[model samples]
Target: MSSNGTFTENEEAPTYAPSIPVPNVQELVREDPSQVPQRYVRDMEDRPKDTDMSHLSSLIPLIDFSLLLLGNKEELNKLDLACQDWGFFQVVNHGVAKEVLQKMKDVAAEFFELPLEEKNKNAMPSDDIQGYGHIYVISEEQILDWSDALMLAVHPSHYRKLKFWPKSPTGLQEIIEEYSNAIRKFGTELLESFSLIMGMEKEALLGLHKQLIQAYRVNYYPPCSKPDQVLGVSPHSDSSTITILMQDDDVCGLQIKHDDDWVPVNTIPDALVVKVGDVIEMWSNGKYKSIEHRAVVNDERARISYASFLYPHDEVEIEPLIDPKTEQLIYKKVKYGDYLRNSMKTKMEGKAHTHVAKVETLA
Candidate 1:
């Protein structure tokens, strides 16, 4: 990784191998929408065509958290401003080793390249909750994403007993275990920092997530000859509390919604792109913005990336970022399950931020 934040832009990066076919838009529409559940279809249906690619002032926002983590209030405020405005940032010196990230990416690629039948065996049936393979319309009624992904729910109790993984990649579990621990540790530190930034107790948010749910998604984007014709993943905010992504150093296709256009974001070699998810935004009473982003499959090559979601325990009470004395609506209190179900049903395109009526929770 370069010491300078900006790298000499590689104008001609090559794509990856073994083309994965993408169905045309008509074909996708013809398929049952229930097969591709995502949260936010109602809002998306109302959005204009121009909403997809509006241009933002800046394409990439980088935040160096070392200063802020050291208790520099000013630096932390500055960083928060960037996040609120830009929604995404490249973090450096945030603790995770570059080698660990590379190894994760390597294992992810190996997992995707295994024989299709083997990959299909782990596929998410419409009904199955846990295990190996991809889940089509896992959200509820969202459109199919151009990418194929495997999801795993691994908490401390189930960390060593992973049920879904490719056998061909002999050491996939070992590689993932190490990477997961590193990420979990890093996430804890970040959560503490976030708590401090919000003028709360250092362990304020961490304590709320007693059974913190951690999920890992291995995403594979096959080469698409027509890059502009379709998207790898639609523009949507993460439903989790935080999303930590490890992208391939070789191929670039991640984009975020800026101003109005979907601006391309180049992944800095060895650096992770961290985003504040909708859950955090809701908890913050909308103080923080959950930026919208999507994956664009490379027309020239196949791409592989790993995304780790740091979520709260299922029963955690999420409220607005207001003090009790204020009595103001900082945010409506909602159960995590309701939010998750709503998010899953809508297509991934910026659905997480859709403001739906709050559901009352029973004691």
Candidate 2:
């Protein structure tokens, strides 16, 4: 398996097999709502057409020219509304240069193409530091996501030691380092906008910033012999606060659940999809939602994606929305570390996550 999570050769393609059913929305909602919470479910009873994306081209908010170039509270609210209600949206002219975006895609492709022996040298040995290569090996968490990934925890400046990076790219390593730094700057700016919309101090999310860890997962989905028989990754919601994904231009494997229907998220040039994750969902008291999404591979070509995860320090406490009242609190306060541990434990046992509890809660 050459870091693509599957063996690749120019040889004859092997027959494909279907993957067992991945946990889906109806099944999730079928569980006790209090135990397995998702805002999309509760709203579905009163509104029947919430998930339809057929006419979504118009329905999906086209961010205005001004909001795309300049940031404002009102614009942030618009973005937040789309996130809360739609769970996914695309933005263009978002400031990051087109060349920079291409570099990220190219470098990720090059990294995955490296020989397996060289790539494994950078494999993560422990789950703690978010090193590099395949964290899912020991994931012991839900079913394994089919793709192989590289993880980088970049933050606080000091934690970004070169040891955690691969030596192959040589100068390319420096380029990635710069890229991560730039993304952090942009991530903070986006978070600031989100904070303002949530009615919190512009810097309210700053303390949790210390533990701000930036993770990059370079995932490769090899062309499956049986493309329709199996999935590249299963359906799952992100556990962090936010995720910025840069998809390869040629692949059309990304999809998201909308109004009880699955809509394809075709990657657009110069567009980045910002996904709201669990922590932000909880912090917003369900005001903002963490939507479930997945990736599927094609039999014709391989696919790659650069997914960057932004998370708070382990000790940071996740509480209700900044407001005292918001649709009645959906969850109790918990630490990010606790949620991670619970996810790991349940995943190891092959169980779908419900509460995403903090271990300390058990204590």
Candidate 3:
């Protein structure tokens, strides 16, 4: 089957699928702890360690949704400052039902617990980005993260390939649909709020697109014997307009780069983590920043996180909006599709594709 869950039209049936076989990290660690792959290990400089977290308390701002919903001026100012200065924040009482939130996390964990063969049924094709599989595997020698993920396009319901969706977990489809819809609504509301925070007419930023591109990614990070040596996800900024993350409440592994140190993000119960992506930075004309973040594996417990990425429609032309008061334009106009492709290519290489969109000026 193809990555999109469609049958391939090959003239002759191949002995094996074109995709590489990924071992179940959870199973491997249980069977033989000593057999951990060497490729998962990182160098000394890349390993995670305990550091002084005195300044962390002020780094990540937490905002109250009740205040945002009521249009409280003080809270709105705080939101604007968080976007401008920190580029990351946690939102409480965002209106998503607690039942739905718990079910979303439960379904994700259940799907990953399925047998290896069943899970591999949705394995992504080498050429495609959707379905269950490893990402950023460009070469044989490239280091692999001790993680697995299931990714799918959720918006524009017609774009969904239902065959790739899991069936073993009863009610998985229904819960996921409900959760995605709630997230979509929340995202639109947040975008409008952002417009207000930016001093533009409400919906000024959101009204540019007729349709929004939304995708869901469920990440499963298995416990590693040498947690310090392996990363669950590499350091990189997202390529979307905004990314909403549902972190694992019981386990902590998410961290963001603050200055020269990596500070852990403390998980707040029933709260969602918001991240500013590269596209937003471009649209804001560099007024907002897309910060770099990474995930590390837990030594004893597995970690699961759900992230929904909001993007401009494929054909949308993204550029810095005109501001009469502004002295110069920092970014150039570019098609969303072109930027996405370039971003994917450079993502694994530890380079920010958004840098290419910067316009040069004589010093």
Candidate 1 per-residue C-alpha lDDT over 113-180 given as tens digits, one digit per residue, 9 for 90 to 100: 66666765665534433444344343334445566677766554343224455555778877877898
Candidate 2 structure, TM-score to reference: 0.76
Q: Kindly list the per-residue Cα lDDT of model 3 for residues 1-363, writing each as its tens digit.
A: 355433333422111113344565766777887566877777787777767564684568998987887888998998888888878899998999999999999988899889878987887877656778876665566667788889887876766777678786899889889999999888888888888887888878776654677889999998887787888988888888999999988898888876657878888889999999888888888888887888888678899999999887666788887673764788888887677767764435333566777786611
The 0-to-1 C-alpha lDDT of every candidate, in the order given, reads 0.65, 0.61, 0.79
Better of 2 and 3 by lDDT: 3
User: Candidate 2 lDDT (Cα, whole model)?
Assistant: 0.61
Candidate 1 regions exceeding 4 Å error are: 1-59, 129-133, 136-143, 159-161, 324-330, 357-363
Candidate of highest lDDT: 3
What is the clash tally of candidate 1? 26
Q: What is the alpha-carbon lDDT for the whole of candidate 1?
A: 0.65
From the highest lDDT down, the ranking of the candidates is 3, 1, 2
lDDT of candidate 2 at residue 212, scale 0 to 100: 65
Least accurate stretch of 10 residues (summed lDDT) in model 2?
13-22
